[model samples]
Target: MWIADQWKDYEVIDTSDGEKLERWGDYMLVRPDPQVIWNTAKKHRGWKKPNAHYHRSNKGGGEWEFFDLPDIWQVHYKTLTFRLQPFQFKHTGLFPEQAVNWDWVCGRIQKANRPVKVLNLFAYTGGATLAAASAGAAVTHVDASKGMVGWAKENAAVSGLTEAPIRWLVDDCVKFVERE
Candidate 1:
C-alpha cells in the first residue's frame, strides 16, 4: 500500500485496542481508529500519558478530554501553517496525511505556465486552497459549513496567501458544481 509517511508534524506512535496514539507537534493524543483492528501491545509512553484523548461515545458523538493541552496549536507543512484544536468529531482542523496531495497539486499548478483556476470542494481549513494559491493558482475554496470556510480563510491569511487569489465560499459543493 502507498503510504503518506512524509510528515514532520504528525505521527502514528502506536495502535492498540481499536485506538491510535499519535503525536501532533509536541502533544500526544489517543483516539479511536477503526483501521486499527489489531489488539497489539501498547508499550508507548505516549499511551501512558497522552496530552489528550478523544473518548468515543456509544450513543453517537464523542468528546475530547484534555490534560494540560492548549485549546489550539499550530503546525506547518512547508511554509503553510494550520491552526489545530481538538474539536467535535475528533478533528484538529488539520489532516497531515493530505500533505502529499497538497504537494502534488502544487507541483501541477507550478508546471502550468498559464494561470490555473482551482476549485477546492469541502475545503477543510484551506490546506489545499493555500497550497494552490502558493503555487500561483487562483483558488475558490468551498465548504458546506460556514465555520469551516472561515477556518480555511484563517489558514490562508496565516500562510501569507491573504493577498492571493482565494475566494472562500460557503455552499454545498454538489449544488455549487451543478450551478457552475
Candidate 2:
C-alpha cells in the first residue's frame, strides 16, 4: 500500500457515505469513492460547502455541481505542477495518489547513468512523462485524446519542463503500440 503523503497542495480531508472530501490547492471538492464503504460521520466542514461536488447518478453517469469553482486550477507535487479540471468520469485531470508512482519514476530515471528514454502510453495529462522528463529522461507522451495531450503540454509548460525532451503525440495507445 503505497501512501502519497508528500503532497502539500492536495489532501484528503475526510471520507463518508461513498464520498471523499478533498482539498486541491484552494478549493474543496466532493467526489464519489467506491472504496469508502463505511458510513463514517462527515466531521469535515468542507463536505457541506465544497467548491464543487460530483454527484453520481444511479443511471451510470454523474454531474458536477459547482460553487464558485474555476474551469481550471493548478496543484504542485514536489517539483511538478499539474493543471486540474473536473472533466468526465469525475476526474480532476490529475490523480493525487499517483504522486507515489511519480516519485518512483523520477528516482528510476535519475538513477540511470546514461540518458534514458521513456514511452508513456495512455498518458493522461502526462504525470509520469513529466516525472521522467524532470529526471533527465527524454519522454514520448502518447494519448488517445487530443485535448488530454494539449492539457499535458500546458502542464509541462507550467512545471518549467517546456524545454525538456518530450514528444507529445495524440494517438490510440493500442494502435500506436502496434504501429511502433
Highest lDDT: which candidate? 2
Tens digit of per-residue lDDT, candidate 1, span 9-128? 888889989899999888999988888889977888898899999999999789999997898888778888888889988888987788889889998999999989999998878888
Model 2, 1-180: lDDT tens digits are 999999999999999889999999999999999999889888788988999999999998899999979999899999999999998889999988988998998898888899999999999998999999999999999999999999999999999999999999999999999999
User: Which 10 consecutive residues of model 2 have the lowest summed lDDT?
Assistant: 40-49
Which portions of model 1 show Cα errors greater than 4 Å? Answer: none
What candidate 2 gets wrong by more than 4 Å, as runs, is none
Give me the candidate number with maximum TM-score: 2
In candidate 1, which residue pairs clash? none
